[model samples]
Target: MRRATTGLDLALAGLMTVAACAEVVISGGGGTALGFGVAATLLIAFRRRIPLVTACGVTVCLIAESVFVEPPDRAVPMFVLILASFSVAAHANRRDAAFGLSFLSLAMITTGALDAGDDVASLLPGWALFVGIPGGVGVAFRKRTGDVAVMEARAAAAEVAALEAVEAERRRLARELHDVVSHAVTLISVQAEAGQAVIDSDVEGARRALAAIGAASQDAVAELHAMLALLHEPSDESTGSTSTGLADLPSLVAGVRAAGLRVELVTRGVSALPPAADHCAFRVVQEGLTNALRHERNAQVRLVIDHADADSAIRVESRGTRHQSSYGGSGRGIAGLRERVAAVGGSLEVLDHDGTYCLQAVLPR
Candidate 1:
């Protein structure tokens, strides 16, 4: 701020001296003192925002030039004052700067018209073009500044969108990991228990149980590795190795149905599920079914899978009226579904308002 004030003051003083040289007598010392003093005082008063003060100060100096200084003929001095004031305003806001530029440009044209002293029409157009061209360019710069601001806003939004997309992908991977890891761990536990239950009574059955446990553990490790791979580098989105899709829905339902869920699935929109959409859709249904079976045993479940050329949808509602216990688990399943679908540019909503638990999901293609 101090530097700016000093620079403006020095510049103003120098311009005043130049205007002094434009005179023959150098005898308007009193007028010079009044005019320069008024502008300098205004400068000091508003030095923090010199552009604002300089605008009015330039007009005051012009008036002082015509009346008190040089006796009505200080064209060069007036023009210099105008230019300096406009230049100061140029660094502020573009709109105000344009106003200042116009003021200076008009002053120049008006001065030129006066110097002609005859055929005002001929002199006016030439003067306007000569002065207005610079003003017009200044106006263009103002517009360019506005354009830059608009582009900056769009860039900011794009950055936000990209960040949101990444977060969504991570959330989706989390849901998939939960399903794969949870199911595999359950199988491993069941197999381990079976092996213990029949350690000696049926050696062959026990061996099969052990083998199943090993396979389940390997599957768990592989699933974990896949999840870690995705988490390590999100950009590695090669889904050629995708194992879970809407095609896996039947087995998922059958798993829960075996646990006495009475799970029934009705699928729609079967023709157009992209790999990403299909995977997310399957996750949503699987989580919903798992939740239903875990909490609401013997509950009749109606699973509706809808897909179309543009969208994939899943809705799982359980009629656990006798139990009222289907949605009693951690409730992370629905929340996880919401995050996963939203990540893939879809939506998930669960509404259990009328003695039934209803889960709806949409994953757009």
Candidate 2:
């Protein structure tokens, strides 16, 4: 693009030089006028780079031509001056452009006074037509171009922000799906194995296990449908049936108990929190219980939720022998939980000592 622009500028300079030289010769202005015209036209090449200097140089050449040659026709020189004036206003800053215009106007008035003597008043229309109009047009063009550049820059920034927002939302959905599927699958697997082990001797026990599996499957399907609804239509409303909070701890604990893990729940203070923090706290407890179920056999788990003046705390502790046939994990559940807690300005910690494992999180209100 730079090469193309440079080529066009050189082409314009060459064409103007030829036309101005021809005009000088036709008017019989002699060698002096031809030299001045060529010099003025050559300065057009550098107008974009040093517009004020180019304008000043062209103005000097025009004045010199009027004084030395006094050409019969001033058409070419006036046209070159108009082009120079436009370039000055278009490329130069306001102070420099204003100075260039004033200098060119003063030079034109002086040149007209020298040629017409006392009849300088009659040259006002020519001065305005050749210099004033072009300078004003150039200023307007510069302002318009600046406005367009600003709008383009703002549009580019907005596009980048939107892309970032989309990527963040995708990560959030992946995390939610992972938590939901992992917890339900873990419960169903444990219940199915228990039901299979007891099917020969204890029909009632097997039937209860099957019922738990059915319940877990139904819950998972409902949660999945709720998540899918968000993809179809975004909303500011809470996730309705799928949105879990402190009040749902009893049901969560009951489900984990039905899956064969022993959980004792304890609570303190009033459970009041912002939606984001409340949701994060629920995930913390859910992830902690899920990890305990996957890794421990006959584990006694204690879940504690404490709401205080400044923050909310959740702690899950499990004590049991490690399961010989424990389920494998991809290690994303705890990491996702950490991200969720951190997103709401919270901190999570996990500890293991001997046969005991503890998960703790603290969230600001």
Positional deviation of 56 in candidate 1, in angstroms? 5.0
User: What is the Cα-based lDDT of residue 3 in candidate 1?
Assistant: 49
How many angstroms is residue 93 displaced in model 2 relative to the true structure, after the best TM-score fit? 2.7
Candidate of highest lDDT: 2
Clashing pairs in 2: none
Q: Name model 1 segments beyond 4 Å from true.
A: 1-28, 31-37, 40-53, 71-85, 88-99, 105-155, 190-212, 222-243, 250-271, 292-331, 343-365
lDDT of 2: 0.83
lDDT of each: 0.60, 0.83
Give the least accurate 10-residue stretch of model 1, judged by summed lDDT. Answer: 40-49
Model 1 lDDT per residue over 102-164, tens place: 554454444444453546665556444444454455456556777999999999999999998
